[model samples]
Target: MTQQNPLPQEDQQVTLISVRDGNISVTSARALVVKAHKIALKIDTALSEPPAWTDEQSLTMIYTHGERVMRLRGVLREQVDTDRITVEPVGEVKEGDRRDYRRADVDARVYARSAGTQSPTEARAAQVALQLAPTSNAFIPQVVNISGSGLGFTAHEVFSAGELIDLRLVLDQPAAALVNVIGQVVRAVRGEGDALNSYAVRFAELSEADQDIIVYTVFSNHFAAEGLSDALDDFDE
Candidate 1:
């Protein structure tokens, strides 16, 4: 079958639906429920992480009346026949709009704290990975440009512009450890190909504890791995 991108611009809301063989079918933005005579599906609601990108996994959906929702896995066969399913791309998600972009280009410093070491670059990298959750699977965001207020990177997922997401940055070293910060998704795209969809997100808020950890990391780096080194180096021998 032919694949096409239905979005007009970057960060536009887009959705891809992969349905189980003979379970549900979509044609031109309309979904049809089908009956599968050969496949047996079991609904699983407890999976914390959805199946990996390659895995033929099924999502549970509530059906009509007394029957429980069924779990539908990935497509197993060709679109015309058999056991496999297909992933249909739906364009124009309504999740967010341009006005929802609160800090897309704000000049705010972003940092990281892992196991207690502090490096602005490393922290920032960790922040990017954490915010891109599930989508940051194989691709890593490389900071192509940075500014006093905002930065930009190559994103791996087609994130809707102005979407919001929580992040958990981990800092762990031989001497210290911590995870901090939450971020909001600013923009994302699938430019050129699925592999090149760059995402751009900005730091929105940091908790007091996270702020302390960042300060501690900076001090450790400045003081040769010594905690609070920058704040206490004046002491006499």
Candidate 2:
């Protein structure tokens, strides 16, 4: 089957998985080029780091854009460079089901408290302290965007990958509410200007009520900004 959706944009984040002899390995990488039937990925390290890749090894890649998840299966091809690898799709690109809550771009304040150093004991203690005194030593970061599942924001402090965090999303206008949730850091990249780091986080366990509020806020803002409220209403009819 031919591709039904547009090609993924360059530099989109992707998770690559390789399985060999019952052992599986996964890595978070970026797409260098997305084509009709192939994709080039920017490899950050030698093949040995994530275990060696043999010729024609079957690989699976999952990527998300906005709210859509795409799953592509292909066989590894020639290595373009020490930092690049190519793969040719085995079949048509499979688009996952649409997310119930779409991501929305919003300028808001995010109050975050890092779980602190890698020491598990220290991290747990810090987490408990924060829970006891929520706003005592929080970092007020600027939220770049958010969705029901996760969010991205710029913070002055660096947050290590896999760190746990407590977040309070503060929306001030149109709809005002303080939504508190816990999340884990997925990735962190340096941001422009002095000392700013961009962090992507995936929400951890959340109560049903909190989940509903986040979904409602994101959808509301997205529709208002896109002027899609009327279109949505027409569709509902």
Candidate 3:
């Protein structure tokens, strides 16, 4: 998020959600934060793909910090090349309690496979996927953010919406915790390139135990980030 008076801080990430004619699209091929005030949000298309978003497109920018989620409306101000976008906050920022399914931005890589949709997320399935991750059959993608119900990642492969996927996520926030689950692609977005780097998967038949594991990891990562920011402030002081 741009370090404007109300915006979060420099280098923070924000999700830009756009809806047009009854279709809701999570424009993730390219979109991130830099800084500013009164700036209309300029969401970018995938750097590899030619720009597709039009100027003056309205959007909702979502920024989550700790237990709070800040939502601000904005419009396309200016496209900063193909890799960056700037949004001018439109109205009063609405702050709300983060839902129980709060998400945390993360960086991790896990094993992925798409045969069809919807399968049981059992312990056995997770174990098999973990073993396969080091092998060639698995398409390893970089996991970006995660919540109890789903996760977001970017990869070279394309998985269409409603497609069921089997995932083997090994998270380090809980020290090499393994999450084996079947999820349906809620959103699959491509960058300018051939890669489908922006994908959101919603868990199907995720066990309560598995869900707890994700929630634990989410909180672990969230607090760790906050702790680091606090340390930085103290050092500066």
Instruction: Report the number of the highest-TM-score candidate.
Output: 2
Off by over 4 Å in 2: 1-99, 116-143, 192-195, 229-234
RMSD of 3: 16.6
Over the stretch 41-150, how does candidate 3's per-residue lDDT look in tens digits? Answer: 33323212223456677766555544345666777677776655666767667663344355787656577667453445443365454455433445353546898668
Give the Å error, residue 98, model 2: 2.1
Better of 1 and 2 by lDDT: 2
A best-first ranking of the candidates according to their lDDT comes to 2, 3, 1
**Tens-digit lDDT track for model 2 on 160-181?**
8898776666654234556666
The clash count for each model shown is 20, 0, 15
Question: What lDDT is reached at residue 187 by model 3?
Answer: 91
lDDT measured at residue 71 in model 3 versus the true structure, 0 to 100: 61
RMSD of 2: 17.9
Assess candidate 3 and give its TM-score to the true structure.
0.47
Model 1 alpha-carbon drift over 4 Å, by segment: 1-156, 172-176, 187-196, 218-237
lDDT of 1 by residue, 57-84 (tens): 3322211111111112233222322222
